[model samples]
Target: MTVTASIDIASSPEAVRAKFLDFASLPKYHKGFFASLTPLGPVEPENKIRVVFSSGQKMYAPIEHNTPTSFAWTGSIPLLFTGGTKFTQEEVFSGALSFLMGENAVARKFGFPEKTKKGWEGYNNDLKAWCEAK
Candidate 1:
C-alpha cells in the first residue's frame, strides 16, 4: 500500500529543514505516534536512528538523505512489511512552504491498508499545524 499527505506552512524551507532534522524533538510535535527518537550515531546520510513508537514498538531506519529540502528513511517491520518514507519541502509563493510525505509499502498477506491511510491523514494534519506554528 502507498499513502501520501501534504500541507503548506508559513515558514521558509530552511527553517523547516532545521526543525525536521532535529530528531529529538519529533515526539514533541508528533504527539501520538512517536514516543521517542534516539540517534544511533552522528547525524548523516545513511546513519541509523531508532524510533520508539508510543505503542512501544521499536523501528530502526537509516537516513536516506539529510539535505535542506528533503529527507527520507527506509525500514521494515519483520515478517509484516517493508517500506520507505520521504519528506520534501518546497518553497511556494509568498515564502510559504509545501511539505509532503510519501510512503510506499509492500505488505504480507495480512495488512490493513485502509487503517494506514487514515492514520497518514491525521499525521499530515498534525504536521501542518506544527510547521505553520513555526
Candidate 2:
C-alpha cells in the first residue's frame, strides 16, 4: 500500500523543483515538518542523504529519483521497511512493509499512511506557498 498527496503550485515546475531539491532549505521554509536537513554530498541518484524530521527521527535514504521536476528517496532495510518521511516533491509510502508488519500492529497503531498523508499535504501547501512567494 502507498499513500500519496500532491497539489498544484502556481510557480513554474523548475522553480518548485529548485526549492524542493534544495534539501538544506527545508527547515527554513518547511519549518513545521522538518527540523533540519543535511545532504551528505553531491545529490544524485545513488547518493545517500540524512534527514532529521521534526519529530526527531533521523533517517538516511538513498536517492532514488532526481530530475528536473521530481525527487524521491528510499530508506530500506533488507526485505522489511523501505520507509521514511517520503521526501518527494510528493508525499508517498511503499514497499513490503507498506501495509504489512507483524499483523499490522505498529502500522495500525500509528496509522502511518493516514498520518503521512496529512504531513504530505502540509508539505504540498508549504511548498506551494514558498514557491509562489518567491
lDDT scores for all predictions? 0.52, 0.62
- Clashes in each model (backbone N, CA, C under 3 Å)? 0, 0
Worst 10 residues of 1 by lDDT: 76-85
How well does each candidate superpose onto the true structure, as a TM-score? 0.63, 0.74
What would the per-residue lDDT of candidate 2 be over residues 9-91, giving only the tens digit for each residue? Answer: 67666666677767777766776655666767778778877877778888887877666545667753211111222224333
Instruction: After the best TM-score superposition of candidate 2, give how far the Cα of residue 27 lies from its true spot, in angstroms.
Output: 2.3
In Å, residue 1's CA in model 1 sits off its true spot by: 2.7
Clashes of 2: 0
Decoy 1 TM-score against native: 0.63
